[model samples]
Target: MSFQHTDSIALSELEGRAPTHSDLESRGITSSKEKDFKEDVKETVADSPVDSDVLIRDGVQRKLGQRHIQMYIAGTIGTGLFLGSGGALHTAGPLGALLAYVIVGTVTYSMICSLGEMTSFAPISGTFPHYAARWVDPALGFAVGWNFWYQSVTSIPTEITAATILLTFWDENINNQKIYTAVICVAVISINIFGVRIFCSTAEFIFSIIKILLIIALLIAGLIIDLGGGPSGERIGFRYWRNPGPFNRAGLVESNIATDQFLAFVQIFVQAAFSFGGMEAIAIAASETESPRRNVAKAIGRVFWRILIFYVFGILMIGMLVAYDDPALLTDTGNAAQSPFVIAMDRAGVKVFPHIINAAVFTSAFSAGNTTLYSSSRILYGLALRGQAPRFLTYCTKKGLPLFAVLISSSFAFLSFMRVSKGSEGVFEWLVNIVTIGSLISWLTINVTFLFFRRGMIAQGIDMRKNVYHNRYQPWLALWGVLWLSMFILVNGYAVFFQWNTTDFLVAYINIPIFAALYFGYKIIMRTKIWKPHEMDLITGIPSIEETELPREPPHTIGGKIAAVLF
Candidate 1:
């Protein structure tokens, strides 16, 4: 799977320089030349193993395992189920929220498969964006990489803000959210700066404890309350749904409920997507795994059940255990003091549970933010390796950490405090909206890239049957993902643009225009044109599956074995 640094047909040979749109038009390079230029760029770019090599260091150290992947996925599942559910319930009503989650979850499940298949085959530090450039089009690669980077950067602050807000429930006198956010951001940065294994191990431990404890506590409390043994007295199963008529008091078409509900559902889809955002982070780390192909395949295969159990079941529990119509649950304060989980626990007669849940929620938010920092830094490092960013970002410390990238990524969280200082939440809201849009765009690009990658594989006579992981109905799945995501962008984005009362439409929807500008601007400046199948990097020829295999490890010493058993 190693790429030869030198090739017979260099990028310069295809285009006197990197072909710009003007150059393509003036040189009269027909569709054929355009395709050739794209292919050449892709092949040349793909030929280097610079980023992957640095990430794995010749595949010597293998730290991530099944547990790490499992917890990593759980970490991404988030406290959204615990806290964010109330908002969804209010917007869509009980049934609407349930259906909305199901719909979005289905799409997410499919997307995870598509991503899993790609990473299982061509595990790399850059992950999907690199594949987009190599297999689809260079413009697409550029768009996705930057879009994801932007999403990751902006998302850090929101997570931190959530952590700070949650902390306030314990002590109202803690006024310095910015200071706390800064401190947490620094701590996460330090963890990531230590290396991927340390970062992942910390994430695994934190997320596993938080997720398991929360779910267990909720299950136990729900059972106790349902069995008529709680402080609140007898069972309340499905009583809330019945009284609420399984829908919000405000109908979908009603001014406050209809428009708001529909829009809120759309926004929640984005939020759900973002909450599941770092699932792909598992694949990004797969390149460094001992057995990337097998492990990634196993991880992706379990995505459906994981989402069902952790997300679907968890939300269903929330809906059943707590009244959707509770005013406390419906509050849109977006402050931590008003967490639905905390309120739900209080109402369910669980003494001291709110504090415990708040602490876990804070840890979960911190974990989410910390993981985003790691993901963003790696993405930046990948971009640098491809010459898309400053080369300095590609440099790794002795511990294999992207120090500069971590610093840059972590700094974005500081901007979260702008909402408090500016007296207008416009900037913060705009950033959140942009993160949504950017993430959607990245997802769309990944699907599109997968479609092209599948085609290139087939054309090159690569047998899909041989792959342990395969994305069924490739072109169809990819096309559907693209279409649905486009609808999300347009339908959701149009509101931002046309809604006259909205203050940050320009900032919120800016990612679309910015992406278009980058694509066309790069095309015009570099004369880059669309590519065809033959001109695609078509790394389907490389046997990455064979190249990546699990390394053997020595048996644990007695002390290690005892620790393993106890732990």
Candidate 2:
């Protein structure tokens, strides 16, 4: 993501034309040879009355602040970690789950580092999918952009459905689920309708804080439970691992300890990958962030801590408290009823904690859906800005909300309504099947794009140190990500192989062919050529971004310093 510097003043010569309010009207830059680029500029500048300009001036306000970006690193910790960890533990045992999460965490951090560099350098709203197009090939960008948008749209309903189930944990006799679904959908959309400041920054910041507090409380409770602080006063220290023996042999047909355990670990690895899926959503707010060079990198740097504390430690606590063979882990009560935390609490004979944890799970589901829909809208807005989607999606309200994109993505929330009644299960399953593998594909694209992007920077003689943000072992880190993930994705549904279930195999591998279709389809139809190293255009957007963003003000006062450190 870093560019080359010719001398000590890396950006001295980089300074170029600045954007002003008077430039709001069409740039009027017409180039028949590069019609797509010309049209992209027009659509961007025209976000409000006309296209995309200085982020503050129009088309998505530079509304996200330091706290928003800082808090948002953990913004999407949803049912996956809270509830799904139980399933992961059940499948892979304690040590296996921990190892799985550590592996994914490593890959996730590598990808994030590369992303931070690119985002710091460009700070474009279009984010990394577009980076694939610019740095790797346009066809790859087209595939990734559409795949990510579709993935986000589908995830909103999935969270809403989880929220409803968590609500039923409170009121089991509740019927006519549509009313509840509609209510949750409205609440999520209502937050975003007001604009980025209200929904993304303020709301998500609050959501993340609550989530962090809840997790810390749970971890403390877990420790107490492990130390026999519960009503039974039974010290349960690592006894479950010793008894069940640290491996479940969950789905294996025959009992080969080594082979079964290895297969089990693979299963949890896939789940762990999904758990860390949305960290890259950090880039979605690039344009709207006040100072991308400063804030975006800060947020990326903190991702490691979030993953360690929230996920790795959280799983450790679950494994410590809940045994792999705990029957509650297999329950179909369809709420936090099956959450390993609640399972642990129930085993400890703690009566009240389940209610508190369930409430948090409900909040988690709602928060995740809220943020997912917001991200989906922004990704669509990016797609439209890049001419990959319908032009109308680029339209923005006066508050810098991508009005049309929001509306379209919001419509997808209705998919949650399928849960209102029976008989739609088939269709719902089909929809979920479509985007099941989207996360791995997105991660793979980021690494691949980074490889090309790095090559381009070197070819142009750009100074690596001059990059707005620099992390060591980059191109190499990204290269490892690319190879490891390609193999990981291929074996994503390894269980399907031993069992030979068509639906499961398809669900696991569906995005592969879909991505290939989008890539080859676009290549054949548009006749676009892959970009050569020297031809990559990192310079086009950075100059305007640097000129438009407010000057960086380093934190000085104690409060500011504390905020900076925490965020």
Candidate 3:
């Protein structure tokens, strides 16, 4: 039967023909339900009337397409793979680092699957925060939304900081560095203010072209170097792997997997995770697309292959070309003069290519910062919609963009300048730490929300297996993501607290207490309780102004058939 949003589905329509609790119980759908207990909750939401006369201003025009989606994914993948892989390689050894990326990518793929199912069913601008409010709890939506906002704010400076450092590759003058960073930030903010389509389309074109070209060049150069085409006619051919021995020199020790290797692995994992972080942006964009269900499903399905090919293979090639033990690889001594990619090109005797690569690195950092701004602002808009934050943030411009939310979110970029004044990298490092924790929280929440969502579906006699976008191996995939995130939080969270010679422990550990305070604090203030399926908001099921006018029959035209197929 086709699904349609109508005023109501009569109880008589369900009547004796409805799937009873015993039927679900016999199918072993027990959780919070039991045999002879009250009947299972229905899938229908309460028919509460909204003030239809009141209009919530529609934000920014929705103009993005499949190309925009593809480019956003490419840009996110490029950021970490191109610049961050060097650090990961140094930590885990070539083999260990490769393994870590593959493992993380696999976990990410699973989480995306869960997210895809939900997004397809209910594509909206609010995305996951809205889902959390509807299917989980309002407090969860608040916490997740604000946490992501903070992350985006902090990342602005982090990316600018990266841009400043990268600038030193060609010019060591600090004055020039400051000017360039300011210009790039202003440009990014302008693009965002203009509209998401403009920002997304520009980013998609530049990033897609650059990333594809870079990958092709790296693959060709790596092959040539491996085949004895270097200055000394030496074939690199996996010698670094053997000499350093699969694991790093410091990591191979018998005691606790060696401090150097373990630290290296942890560091690389953090970077890899950061690089892969923006994949979730696709879910956010899914809301604005013309055919969200099909586009979102296609995007999520491509993630596994994208991570493996773009991240895994890209790092493998980089490691083979440059030995992990090279002292230059460790030059992150707070100096931008020492990018591993630039260093590798120099070592390979390609004098001019290093400059070319440096330029690309600068653009990549700016693009990351730009996208972060867009994401964080959209989340703020989501929060405002749920009455978690101030209502003014819900204001949208004629273009349909949430102008106030974007401005408020962009203000966080000013905080990045504080890093310049302090002359201490501590602020920047603290920001990164907080971003990591926030990401972990988001990951955990998504999985937990999915668990409840799936259970609710079964309880209401909705067979998810029959849905177009299905999540098999239910609680297992969600459970794995949660477990991994928990382990990361425990290990990394405490590491921030107990660092041997650092005063930033409190700053780093502050996110946990802050997150806790927000969650419980909002729960009390809002008087929100956990939700059951039947009580969920059902925002997606609510008919839009346009949809409300259409007849409730399956279309028969060729165009209609195509639209149905696509959606």
Candidate 4:
């Protein structure tokens, strides 16, 4: 595997004195792969690193460009934000839910900052897990990689369910939701199987642009409704917050109102985490992106705006437009009708726009599902490259699509059809719980992994901000993420204890033991050691001196400048 991105140290573009054998020994950079890679960098994450004498093309294609990276990150703005946020609002009230999202958004942004720093330097498909193996513990990598893959598999169905649920807005009487699920599933799988080039450049980019436009439109429309721009001309200005009183006590109310409301707020963290779940796919996309060193950093740096416009503003608007206690929010129809945006429109005597919003949401669900499938397949391929998954999973088509990996990942999405027997809304809740647990786990692991990455870089005398992307708050920002994420992960399943529901408990916390088993089991069986900071493999993926090219120029045209700043 030959990595294509040029690093400041590894690339010949920046002239500097090369480190001598004695200089390297003094720094304790003892990895044999690190030393050997200086002469011949085997870099692509598409397959195992091979000998330079007889190298092959990386299995995955680098087709995604800056535009694709921008929209792909925006793709997570789907069912969770548009539809599921109503549930979060219902559970946590207006202010409570608003605060929950804001808190989760902060931690998520920190993780993205840390992720951007490394990906700009060593952009790879497996992403955080691969970083873990090189910078922290190999056992942690094995466990986290599989955990992340499971998270990806489960995410596909959650989005599928969201799409099927949205279809009920058109025909609530259709009982065979399984048909809708299967149809949606086929559409998503087909787009992915079409190959990464068409998948990202065409279908994926279109999906992202549509979602972004719709989100902006919704934000504007929501603000208007809040200010009495509707047919009814009713200014609902925080009236719901006054009457409902900004806190919804959970069903686990064996305690006082404050405790129950606290539990309710705690539960919303899970929902919000689910809403912000797919940020890591940005780093995952780095391996397949054209010029990841430049484009991936640009995409990640723009995350603050994405979260502000897509989540924080949207949450505030939802809270102000609709009352948390509205019966419509908890509806069993599990479609667009329960959506706060739809509810706000309906209450404001707005007729046609609900359908329009519902259609946008329908598109959002499909786009999110497509992203989940693509990320999952690539993750499996990454695992195969590391010898964690089966070798057959690494096989790719001539166009560089991971064929077997796509098929296997698509198979897991069939779980969406389980709603045929379980019912749509119930199944949606169950799957959301499961997926949220997986997402929180993945985020916490990424933060911890970044901490280790930072220590290794510092110990090896690598400069964080010298020609490399980095946050000044650094290890502190990552620490903040670790602290909060761990708290949420622990408290997520606490409500189940009050209610004593076996299913909820299992769905909410089962990943913990499974993750522990995988981590410790791999450690004991493989006899892997926790890598020290100086011993980490930081240079393997960096470009060798021979691989550097002329530096990229600044954007000259208006269009190019717009893309440079926004995408």
- Per-model TM against the reference: 0.82, 0.89, 0.83, 0.88
lDDT of 3: 0.67
Candidate 1 vs 3: which has more lDDT:
3
Clashing pairs in 3: 59-400, 59-401, 60-399, 60-400, 60-401, 61-399, 91-264
Better of 2 and 3 by TM-score: 2
Report residue 304 deviation for candidate 1 (angstroms).
Answer: 1.0
Q: Given candidate 3, what's the lDDT at residue 238?
A: 90
The residue ranges of model 1 lying beyond 4 angstroms of the native Cα positions read: 1-63, 223-229, 249-252, 255-267, 332-337, 419-425, 473-476, 493-499, 502-504, 540-543, 551-567
Q: For residues 106-221, what per-residue lDDT tens digits would candidate 4 score against the true structure?
A: 99998898888877767765678777766678788888888888888887887888898788888775686778888999999999999877877888788788888888988898
Q: Which candidate is the best by lDDT?
A: 2
Q: Model 3, stretches more than 4 Å misplaced? A: 1-60, 249-267, 333-337, 422-425, 466-468, 471-473, 493-504, 539-567
* lDDT over C-alpha atoms for residue 106 of model 4: 92
Who wins the TM-score comparison? 2
As for candidate 1, its clashing pairs are 19-526, 19-527, 19-528, 20-526, 20-527, 21-527, 39-535, 165-336, 252-258
Weakest lDDT window of 10 consecutive positions for candidate 1: 1-10
Worst 10 residues of 2 by lDDT: 5-14
lDDT of 2: 0.78
Candidate 4 Cα errors over 4 Å, as ranges = 1-57, 173-176, 251-255, 421-432, 544-557
Q: Residue-wise lDDT of candidate 2 within 76-121, one digit each (tens)?
A: 8888888899989999899889888888888888889888888887
TM-score of 2: 0.89
